[model samples]
Each structure stands twice: as C-alpha cells, then as structure tokens.
Target: MNAQSAADPSAVNRFLKSVVAWSALFLVIVLLAGLVDPRYLDPQHKQFLFLLGFIGMWRYSNAFMHYCRGMYFLYWKYPRMRKQADKLGDQALPSEIYMVVTSFRIPSHTTYRVYRSVFEEAARVGVPVTVIVSIVERSDEVLIKDILRRHIPDGAQVKLVIVRARGTGKRDGLAHAFRALSRQMPADDAVVGVVDGDTKLLPGCVANAVKFFKLLPTVGGITTNEFCEVEGSELIRQWHALRFAQRHVNMCSMAVSKRVLTMTGRLSFFRSKILIDPLFISDVEADHLDHWRLGRFQFLTGDDKSSWFSLMRAGWDTFYAPDSNTLTVEHPPEKNFFKATRQLMFRWYGNSLRQNIRTTKLLGYERLGLFTSYVLYDQRVSMWTCLLGLTVSLVASIIYGAQYIIIYFLWVAISRTIMTLAYAFSGHSINPMYPLVLYYNQVAGSAMKVYALFNMNKQSWTRQKTTLDSGSGRFDAVLNQVSSKIMLFSSLCIFFGAVSVLIHLTQRAY
Candidate 1:
C-alpha cells in the first residue's frame, strides 16, 4: 500500500470524528439562536434574508475557498512535493548560502538570540555560510562577533561580515547588506537568505529550503514557516498566534500553485544572483506605487512586499518551506491595546493595499497565474464585503430590534468557530481563544483595510519610528492626511446612510 493507504483507516476515523464534533457544535449554536428569537427565521423578514446573502457572498465565499485550497494543499500538493524533496536530498548539490540579517534598534538580548540561532543553523548546514550582519548600532558588532565565536562550531565553514548603515530604516540596512554580498561575487546557484534581526531560525531551516532550489531551478525565493515569542497579555499572545496560524494555511494554499504571494521578510530565501542585481537592490531601497489621489509615494515599510514584487516582475517562481520554521520576537508597538493594534494594522494593511494595486497593474493575469491573480483581486473585494455583516447588523438592529444584533453575533461565533476548526487540522493548536480573535480580525481588520486604501501613501514602520516620503513636502503631507480623513469620514457616513435608507424601504415593503 502507498503512504495514503497505509494511513487511510486512521485518517478516515479522524475525518468522521471532526464531522461529528462540528455538527454538534453547529447544531447547538443554531438551537441557542432560535431560543433567543423565533423571528430569526421569520418568513416575513426578507431584509434579513438579503442581509444573510450579502454576508455569505462577502465573507463565507472566501472562507470556503480557503477551506478547499487548504485541504488540497494538505492532502495532495504537500505530500507529492515532500516525496520529490526527499528524492532531491539524495543527490549532492553545490549550494552556498549567504544570509543578510538586518538589525535596527533591536534589544541586545534579542540580537544575541537571533545571531546564535543563525550561526548554529549555519554550522548544521555544513556548507559555506556567509552571514552579512547589517546594523545601525556600533556596539552590536562586538556582541555579534562574540556570539558567533562561541556558538558556531570550530570546524564549520562560516564567515560573518558586519556592515554598518546610518540607521535611516530597515530598507537602508538591507540595501547595505545586499551591496556587501554582491561585492563577494557569489555564484548564481548560491542561495541568499534575508531575515529580520528579531527572528530565530529553527534547526534544519536553511537545509530544508535549500533542497527546493535543487528540485526546482526556476524557483526564485522561498519563505519559511514562522512562529512567535510574544511578550504581553494573554489576549495579545493569542492574537499573534492566531494570525500566524491563519498565515500558515494561506501560505500553504498559495505555495501549491507555486506562486506564494509574499516572500515574508522575516525569513525568506532567494537566488544569490537576484540579490546581486542592481535593479533588485534599487527596488528594495526605493519602491513605491503611483496612487491617483496621492500621487507617487515611496514605500517606507513592507520591504518584503517590495522584494516579492521584484521577484514576480522578473518572472521568478516563489515557494514556501512548510518545514522551515522561524521564531519572531514580538514587541507591542503601543502600550494601549487598541492603539497598538491599529498602528500595526495601519502599517501592515497599508503596505498590502499599496502593493496589491501596483502588482495587479504591473503583472496582471499573464504574469501571475490565474488562481493567484484572482486571489489578488479578491483582496480588494473582500475589504468591502467583510464590513457588510457588521454594518448591516447595526442598521437592522436599529430598525427591527436588538435581537437582530444578537443573532448576528451568534452567527459570527458559529461561523468563525467552524473556520478555526479547519485551521486546527492543519497542525496548529486549537486555541480556545481563536474564535474570538478570528472575529476580531475580520471585523477590525476590514475597517483598517478600508482606512489603508484611502491613505495608501501614508507608510510608516511603527516599531522603527520611521516614515516614508510620499513625494510631498510637510504642507502636502498635512493636506493629504486631512483630506484622506475627510474622505474616510464621508464614506462611512454615506455607507450607514444608505443602509438606513434600505432598512426603511424594507420596513415599508414588509
């Protein structure tokens, strides 16, 4: 019997158990909602039916797509690819790895941990590993050297080159490292890895990714699976973990198509020749999108997105290393939960929105595969669709009764719980807090995306305390911010006003 058949009986049993558990939970939720209000199923409430359809189209459709894609990845694509990777491992390949680790003002302890992890992994790889350390602090040089001296094995062929940059931003730090690596004149087959200074690689991280290069010559870059070391409240920790869990599933799904969207900067591997290209460094240093409203603004953050775009533009396929794991140290950007979450979301969603527009315009369906291209388009549509449920709930509650809001919450709870269960089967711990965090992301994150779309040019690395130039002066920046806020406020008012009008019409019709 094949591997699938050898495990078929156990897999079937697990599937049956999941179905039973999910059905029970779902039925319980439905029964509870009915007990709260029989009007939840009132035949006369056509408005609620319309609202339900809208919610299904806007939210559930994407959820369903992710479910299907996740299953395909777990069952078909990953297993077949794993077998191929295993075969490739049997052959010898001349692969040199150059890692560029960018550090700004990371804590000394964190810096030491990151370097130790890198050097240890480099030794384990048993290849020529050159780590280009980019830092703004002169003091870190001594610390890094000491760590490398102590941690790296004595016989390991590892070299450390420290490059000091002006602390301008991460982009500048990375640029300096890339320039230094390019000066070395490495071979085209060499693998270049870019990682944040706050991230630690697990054992076999580099070796796991290198096999892909030998297996697929056309592959330009591969990103690793990332976990985090979050130091904060339980809520914050769970929130961060939940995001990574969702990210893993999404990355796996996209990798099946060999077009993973973003080669995450946390720990992404690339072809050495690509990093040496002048255009690649230039794009990474100064990448921007032309916005109709805000004009052309250089990107300040999201260097990962910029690098991913460059790879896509150059027609290089990207993959994800599911087995390669990195641990990121998370520090809260703001003291207040709401403020911290918003600032982080603003930077993240802003980068995504900026890149989404430019990538679609530049690459399009021809360059990006059909499925990947459609996913990119869906990013824009989902922004609006995600908000519809919340908006409609509020309007309907004001018109009909508060029970509508209760029913809406119940539905969200049930649906998100089901979605989170699917994620659990993907090998992540099924946190009890996941359902709440999932809903929080969908509702709060959607609003953040809408704000980001309007203020696409406003880019900043919240943690690094740096902002990108929007190709405008102080006066223009102020004006743009003010104008964007006004537009956002007006849009929100119009959306609610239209919902109110719809509710009135539905009330009269019924």
Candidate 2:
C-alpha cells in the first residue's frame, strides 16, 4: 500500500478514539470545574463562556468548509477540471511576461546566475520577456548593469533601472521598483510579474499564470503556492515540509472559497493598471504607509500585505492559482524558538491590527469579522484566549486554594497531549510517519507559544542566516545548545530545592 493508505484501518480507529477522548475530557472538565465552583456558568462569566463557544464554532466552521470543498471538487468541478486541461493542452500563451526582479545589495555573480535561469525559463515557455533589474544601491549600479549585459540573451529586452533611495529600507527599494515599472510599462497593454531575487519560478509557471489572467478578466492579481527549497538534514527537512504543508493546505482552502485575506509575494502577477493608478502611487517608500494626497486617507505598512490590502480596498479581488508555484528558502533554524516567535508575534500582531483597522473601513464591522476569523483569529485572538485562560486559572487558584491549581495544571497537560495526538493522527492521511513527526512539532510549538507570550513586544525583522553545510544533522547544532542549557538549569534548581527540603525535614524530626 502507498503511504497515504498504508494503515487506513488503524488510522480510522485512532481518529475515532481521539474524538471520544476529547469529548470525555471536555465533559470531565465541565463537571469537575462546576463541582468545584458553580460560578463559572454565572451570568457575569457568560462573556468568557461565549468566547469559548465562539472558538469552538470557528473550528467547526473550518471543518464544514473543508467538507464543502471536497464535495464541490468531486461532484461539481470534476468535469470542469478535466475540460480546462483538455482545452489548454500544449498551447502557448499570447501575453508577454516580464519578471521584474527588485534587489538592492545583491552581488553580481548571484544576479547573473539567478536572472539567467529566470530568463531561460521564460524563453522555454515561448514567452517574450524583459528583465528589469531595479538596483536599490547606487554602488551596485555599474556591477548589476554589467552582469545583465553579459548574461542576458540577445534581443531579450533586458533593461536596467537603477534607483537610489535616500533611505535604504526594504520598503523604499520596492517602492522605487514599482514606480519605475509603472512608468516603463506600456500604457495600453502588458502584465508585469513581480518576483523576488531569492525565488525560483517552476517550469511553465509564468505561462500558466498568464493564461489564467488571459481567461479571467476579473483577476487583478495571481500568486503561486510557496515552498522552502534549500537542502537540509532530516529534522530540518521535516520542519520545512510541515511548515509548507500547513500553509499550502490553509491557502488552498482559502483560495477555493474566495477567503484569502492577503496575497503572498513569492511569485505574484499583477495587471499593469493596478500598480500605475494614481490612487496606489505615492512618493513614500514601498514598505511604509502612504497617505493619499487626493483623499487624505492613510495606507501604511509595506510588502505583500500592504499591496493586497490596497487592491482589496480599491474593490479589486485577488485570485490564487496554485499551479503557478515557486520555491524560496525560509530564514534558517533560529537561535531559539523564543527569538523566532517573538519576531512573528510582533509582525502578526501589528499586521492583524492594521488589517482589521483597514478592512473595517472598507468591509464594515459585521463583514470584517468573517475575514478576521480566518486570518487574525489564530495569531491574535487565540493567543488572547490562552492568556485569558491562564490568568483566570491563576486567579481561581489564589481564591479557591490548591485543589483548583492542581486541576488546572492537569487539564492543561492533558489538553496539550491530546492535541499533539490529534495532529499526529490527522497526518496519517498523508504519511504514517507524520504522527511521530507531529509529536516533535507539538513540543516545539508549545515551547514557542510560551516564548511568544513572554516577549510579545520585541519588534524586529532581522532574518536568521544559516551557513551552508555538507554534513548530516546540520541544523541540530542550535537545538543541542538550547536543550543542554534547559537541562542544566533545571538540574541545578531541582538539586538546591531538594537539599533545602531535606534540611527542613530533619529539623522537624528533631
């Protein structure tokens, strides 16, 4: 049997068992907590109880969405999928695609090799291409120009747009590139594709995306699914795979339902009109928010989310075509989960808040909640729930004595264990070994949650760098350091505490 269906019988049983266990645990917690203190269901605590119900309902909604998608895929779109393939078989797309590579400090050798491959890919698919290299640094201007001249295929329309920004920030560089592209693109036609320097477009990716755009006039933007492509050891490989799997699954579900809140930047194609419009244009850096001189409306934050938000606010809908995919490496293994999550918490927090604010003005309050539940709930509200639950438990312990404290701790441990198991069992539909992989993942995620909450305000965006390694277990170095430090500290604390207790016991005997 294949990996996906290898242990179907056992997997089915395990899933049923997990459902029963979770239901029993919920019943026990409710009965026990009620027996201890009946006030939990009181009118005053009803808001918290309602919040708990809301979270439960959200999960049920997600499950229902998946079920609907499966039904649609099997019954409704089964013929459509086949027909689309049959019609488009071996046909060349007519639109010319220019992949604009925007970079500031990228070295010449890297530029030549990366763009050369990109150029070749475009050529292979019969798309006439122009590569516009927008240099953020003036110093690399001559070098990048020289690299393009030597590497670009003859008559391939390779042009260089060197941009010198007064402020050397990521946003500034991207803004400069967008502005330059807007001016250079044909006023009547042309779809400019935006891709990063580090990203590699897969075979036929451009043709597929352009074809979709050609067929669907309403599509203002199209993006492919992203994955980490860097070589690594088994553990690191698993980590990257899991990360990619989780995101793609979520995005696929979102895309099919028209629910994706923000379009990613790995490889996205935009209609030329959207970028060049007077409303989207601004003199400020690309990464920063721009205040419209025409309407006094402020649109802040840069990068992918910012662009998508601007488009959505202007009444443009983004369509995600998963076939147009690419791979780019993630920031390598972090110094610790704490450092990594600290960065994520701040970015997600700020972005969530900013999006909420922006979308509320556009979509209104009630409609905004639907979007928030999908995109913002896990990053912002789930963390809030965890924090509130912990605080309530702490307060209850102080007032109701040690019994509640023991029960709360036990409840948390049991919940964590069951969630880890459920995640493991879910992985069986993909790989039998995925359960074991998820066990490691669960522990790491829980530890990161602790770290994220502790350093929630440390806002920084530095990417963690990894040195190339040609040996086994390369990313495990930092993991070992962290594990050893944790063990050493816990051992010392336990030893001193045990000694103090022994002395106290001896004095009591005397």
Candidate 3:
C-alpha cells in the first residue's frame, strides 16, 4: 500500500486508542482522589475542592494534549513520511549536499565513528558530497583526515575540507565552516547538513532528509530523530533515555504543524542558500537578546535556538524527521549524578528560555502559526505551574498532616507512569525508572528554568572547556544576581502566603 492509503486505517486506530488511554487516565485520577481523601471529590467544600481540582486538571490536560498530538504523528505523520521516503530510495537528486561536522576535543573513537558514518551515508546517496570537518585543535587534523580518507568509498564524489577555528565554541566552528562553504558557492538547490562531532548518522539519514527539500520548498531546515549511546550508571542511562523519549513526542507534535521549535544541532539539514546569507554566520555566532530586566546578554549556549530563530525570522519553516536517526555519544559532564544533571539542565534550559522570550517577541501568531505560538507561550506558563503544584502540596501537607505528602507522591507516581505508557505507543519501550526521572525533570527542571531565566547571560559549553560571560559590568552583574534571589524569595512567599490564607478560610468554614 502507498503512504496515504496506509495512514488512513492506522490513524483511526491510534485516535481510538488515544481516547481510551486518556479516559483511563482520568479514571485513575478520580480513584486516586478518593484514596487520598474522601472529601477531595465531595462537592460540599466547593471552594477548596475547586482549587484542588483546577490544579490537577490543568496538569493532566497538558499531558493529554501532548498525548493526542503525539498519537497523531505516530499514527499519521511519521508513517506517511517513512513510506514516502522509502519510495525515494537512494535516488540521487540534482543538488549537491555539503555535510559539516564540527569537533572540539571529542574523543578519538567518537570522531572516527562520526566521520565513518558521514562518508558511508554520502556514498550511499550517490551525489556529490562535500564534507567539511570543522575543528579547533590542529593536532587532531591528521587523525580526522586519516579517518575520512579511510572511510571514503572509491569513486564516490566526495571532497574533504577541514576548517580550523580559534577553539572558541561550536558556534564559532560552525561559523568558520559556513563561511568556507559559502566560498564554494554551492547551488541554491544544494543542502547543508550539520552534525555534531559526537553524533553518528544512521544509514539513509542523509538521503531521507535531503528528500524533504524536494518535497517542500518553503522548508528551511529539518532535524533528525536522535538516539544515544550513554556510558554511565543505570540511573544516568535511564535519565537520558527518558529525556529522548519525551523529546520524540514533543518533536513529533511540533512537526505536524511544521514549526519545530529548534532544529537540533546534533543533526540538522538546511537549504544551502540559507548559509550563504552574509549575516547568517554573525547571527548564529553572536545572537543575543535584550532582556528588560537582565539587560542585553549574548547567548552563551544554544546555537540550535539561534539557527532556528534565524530561519523563522527569514520566513522559513522548520521540520522534524522521525525516520531519520542519529546516535549521540553521551558522556556525563560530572561523575556525581546531581551535579552533572544540574549543570546540563542549566545550559539546556538557559538556551530554551532565552529563545522563548526572543522568539515570542519577534514572531508570534502571524509567523509561528497558532499551535507553535501557543506552545511558546505555554513554555513560560508551565514553569510556574509545575513549581506551584509542588509548593502548594508541600504547604498543605505541613498543615494537614504527612499523609498529604505521601498521597501526593503516590499521585505523581501513578500519573507519570500513565504518561510513560502513552509514550510507549509511539515506539518507546517502558522503562521502570521513567517515573522517578519524570518527577525529577518536572520539579528540578522547573527550578532550573527559574534560575536560567534570570541568569541567561551566564553560559558554559560544559563538554568543551569554554565559558561565555554575559558581559554585563560588575554593578549590573551583582544587580542581576540580587534580583534573581529576590524573585525566587518573592515567589515562594506568595505561594506559602496563599496557602496560609486558604487554610485559615477552611478553618472559618468549618
């Protein structure tokens, strides 16, 4: 059966399954409420009960939306794309492809693997491929070139260009590579693929992504589905796996609307002409946002966000390819789980918050479309909601006995497990550790978002030994720090104060 014909029945089945799954989730919440407190469902205490209901419903509604969108993509969008891509089947297109791989202090083994995968895919595509190896260390040039030479298939039209940067950051290395590619004056129809040093492209990834360019002229960039090879404790491995699972759902949801938030730097394909724009390199390398409270600060990380924003501003659509996969070699930044995860979150969320503010300001409903715009706005609101739920529950537990806390934990466990099971329908297997990791991401990750928002100027490429200062003067830096602390203090005070008032009112009602 063809792509469209196959998608029809699967779509209906998925829709029915999603409805059943979500309805079951709602039932679970109702049962859990009774288990926690018989009065929770009692309508007699409408005021307090309504408040509690709103909190629970809001959280579950968000999850439900993601579930629905994810199912839509899994049952319809991804399967359709895969079938279409299969029909294309390694047929060489008219345009050349320039693959740029940027490396900075990557392990020798990882570098070899990345290069080998790139060359192999390039040969399979049967098109003229220019591989740009962007690096900082001069010593590694021989090693990288040797790998490239060994991997390049005989008679394949592949050219290797090695551009050395100042060892600054990935952004700088990318800038150098783009400039070099521009000098080559590749055809407007040609495509550019950017893969990080640690990422290895799966077979057919390049061919699959390039086909999208022909399918959609307005598409400026596309990012691949990513898997990982993490070397760490089981906790760390599960943590990474859980994150990618969540990312897959979110990416698929965004892809349906053709406005994926970020064209992930790990493996993204772009129209070669986009790179030729004179200002493109500058925008990617030195992108900054003028925060009203934080002042003007250059982004320290998140090159992916900058690139995505640039494309959106230039009126280009970004997409996610669920079929195209890349394996990222993941190494924990620090051995201590908490410390390692915290540092990673700081950079990840810091970039996200920075992009969120700027993107919403620059292009809202008109440019981002309805769904994408709403998702952008939701990012800001979700941070507070996640934290507020925790704070209120903790305060209520303190006032009404420890069972409230225990019951809250039980509710979280049940809710997140249900969400994970929903994700399994999208091809991810259920991991026993997912529930714990889910809570960690919601609670700890939300806290990090707060910090990242205030400290947007502070950034570090954790893997690479480089840090970018926000460049604010001493006085301004100190002021930013103080302001952040005050904001946190004020938020906590407001939450607890509200809970205190609620408790007092409940006493009066009794």
Candidate 4:
C-alpha cells in the first residue's frame, strides 16, 4: 500500500451529503430554467457556450501540463538523485547538527513520540546533534528529557537543551527556542532543523533529508514529504492523503527548479549559516507584511513562509527530500467537516498569499528563475480561473436552460477524472472518489484562497486559538469586517459581470 491508502480504509467510500443536496438543487434550478426558456438549442447560445468552454479548458490545461512535467521529475529525475544519495550513505550527512522541536499545546503523548523519534534518528545518524526542546509546559520538557536519555546511543554525542517560551504562539515559541539554539554556537558547517510539536520524524528521516543539502551545495533548505495521521472521518483521511500525494508531485516539480514555494514548518532543515544568523532568526520569530488595506500587521502564523522568503532574498535555494520522512498528527479544529476544512485552508493559503505578495515584488522572473516566478504569478490568477467553470456554467444554466448546465457538469466530471487519474503516474494509490474530491478541492479551495487573499491580516492558530490583536476598538473591528465583505462581494460581482459580457448574455435574450 502506498502512503495514500495507509491513511485510512477510504473516508470517501460513501458519497458526500453536500454533493447530493447540491445535485438536487441544481436539478431543480435546471428544470426551472428549461421550463422558462425555449431557445436552449439556439446557435448564438451554442457559440457562447463554446467560447466560454475555452476558458475552463485553458486553466485545466495548464494544470495538466504541470502534472505531466511534475511526473517526469518525480518518477525519473528524483529517483536518480535518491539512488546517488543512498550510495553516499552517512558520508553525505552534516558533521554536527542542531534540531529545535517546539512543543506548544500539543498532546503529551505526541510530544513524547516526536522527541523519541528525533532522538532515535540522532543515534542512528551517529552525529553529534544538539537538540533544543522548546516547550510551554514543564511536563513535556521532563518527558522529552526522559526520551533523550533512553535513545542516546552508547558513546554518542547527543546533547539536549530546553527553552521555555512565552507561549503567545508558535512564532513566538520558535523565536525563543531559536534564539537559544543560536546561543549554542553550532559549527559554521552544521545543519539546523526545525520540527513542529505535532510532527514525528520517521526512522532515518534526518539522514535521508539532510544528505540532500550536502549533495546540492546550492540548496539552503530541505523539507521532507509528509503523510498525515488524521483524527476524523475516512473522507477527511482520504482528503489528507490526496493532498499529500498532490504535494509530493508539486514538490518534486518545484524541486527540479531548486525553488519550492514554501519550506514546510512541520519538519524542515536549514543550513546553520542561514538559521543561525540573528536577522534570519528574527524574521521567523516576528515577521510582518506591508499591505495597502491591512496595513503593516505582524504575522501570527506561517513562520514557514517567513523562513522561505528570507532564503529567497538571501539567494539561497530550497527544495525537499526525495523520500517521505515525517508523519503529521492532524486534529480537525472543528467537528463539522466543511467548517474544519475551510478553517484549515484559510490559514494554509493565507500564509502563501501573505508571503506571495512580498515575493512577487521582491524577486521577479530575473531572480526567481523563469518557471518559479510564473508559478507564483499563477497563484494570484488561478483562484479566479478556478471559479470560471462553475460561474459560467451556472450563469448559462440560468439563461440558456438546463442542457447547458448538464453539459458543463459532464465536462467537469470528465476533466476532473483525467486529472485524478494522472496521479497514478505519480506512484501514489488512486481512489475512486478522487475525481469528486479533486473538484471539491478546486472549487472550495479557490473560494477559500479568494477570501484569504482579501483578508490577509486575519491570522490565527487552531490549537492555540490565537489571532492577530489588530489593537483596534470594537467599532473599528466591525467596520473592517464590513469593508472586507463588501470588497469580496463586489469583486465577485464584477467577475460574474465580466463572464456574462464575454458570453454576450448581458442582454439576457432567450
């Protein structure tokens, strides 16, 4: 079984209730539109549908091309590099390493497992590694200490340092721990690792991942592939599995260019020269983005993006391990699946968009390389394009009749199936529900990205329940919320209006 099937027996064994209800509503609307119209087969309407179809095709075609390109690197190029690293064995590893594991509001059992795995890897690597444990509780510190003592190999130079943070959030916690980690004065050639509290390192994960840094002198940072252990329904597990599978392909694609968008915070390693620098450490601790409306608000999440931005500006290349090397324990912040997923996407995409704006202006095609810059630019436009199929189809459905809607749904089903089947080439197990899930991810994810793009300063932590203070009065907060909604709603109206004009349906002739 591949990493995908290992997540659960298939949360998608049953269909989504939302899908059923949506289909019912759509059928009802289609019927109404059909009954009210008699020109569903008009040639002008046909011309409009044909023209609008191209936009949907354009967006999906780009994705298909990316998948094909990504598959070539993932299955072909990456394996060659992996075999070369495997042959080098321990020779490819750093001389000495420092790993900082932050444990804040994470379950104690998970904290123990994470530390134990880190210690075991240290012992296996047989290197002198100093682990800095950042914790908010005394119990986890004591627990990690016990784990370290038990896993230290005989005669191995395994050292541990514990730092307590103010517990404001992960960014603050990492700043506290990293400042201490820098104080240890690791060697100039050493490697520095950052591990989140909920992520566990797999066996030999450190050696496997860190070796890439030694192999590629240009690489300044490396993050490993991840599989999630989700605490939710089978559907959620499958969603996580599908997401990881997609991430693996995307990472491999970006790695070939030596520039991944984000070096994941769950488990990633950096060159000591970069992380140990005081300025670099400070960026991860309390980074802020300047925006026109959001103003200059400090980041409350996405420490990972901050690290990647610093690397980009400093001219350091970043990529990922060719192997799956970590397991993230996922707990949905809410019980309702839709609410939980939206919350997660808000934070995840919000990070990318927040950093995306700065990077767009900071590093253009000249510095960021050709394809990398294009991908970043696509991140800005893809949200609008993603909504085109549904938006155009729904508009046409309401006018030209249900036939248009039916035909649009057929295209969506067929297109998404082709997209999901392409994952088979990615070497991950394929699920029957993947096509449906992929559609949901695109539509819902695009919606979430649009919202996050507008509300960039709305940052928060799920486990910590921490948010950006804003430091504004209650009335000011209400006004800001109203302004955000108006902007989002107005932009969407403009988008729909543009589509209506393109289809020549502005006159609403039937």
Clashing pairs in 1: none
TM-score of predicted structure 4: 0.88
Report the C-alpha lDDT of model 2 over 355-438, residue by residue, as the tens digit. 544455556535434644445445544433334334444554565454445555555544543433433322212323343344
Q: Is candidate 1 or candidate 3 better by TM-score?
A: 1
lDDT score, candidate 2, position 335: 46
Best by TM-score: 1
Task: Give candidate 4's whole-model lDDT.
Answer: 0.81
Model 2 regions more than 4 Å off: 1-94, 105-113, 138-167, 187-189, 230-241, 283-301, 332-334, 365-380, 386-460, 463-510
lDDT of 1 by residue, 99-151 (tens): 99998888899989999999999888867889999987878999999999888
State in Å the error of residue 443, model 3: 0.3
Q: Which pairs of residues clash in candidate 3, taking residues 3 or more apart in a chain or in different chains? A: none
Tell me the TM-score of each prediction against the true structure: 0.91, 0.61, 0.89, 0.88
Order the candidates by lDDT, highest first: 1, 3, 4, 2
Candidate 4 differs from the real structure by a C-alpha RMSD in angstroms, to one decimal, of: 5.0
Q: Give the better candidate number (2 or 3) by TM-score.
A: 3
> What lDDT is obtained when candidate 2 is compared to the true structure?
0.53
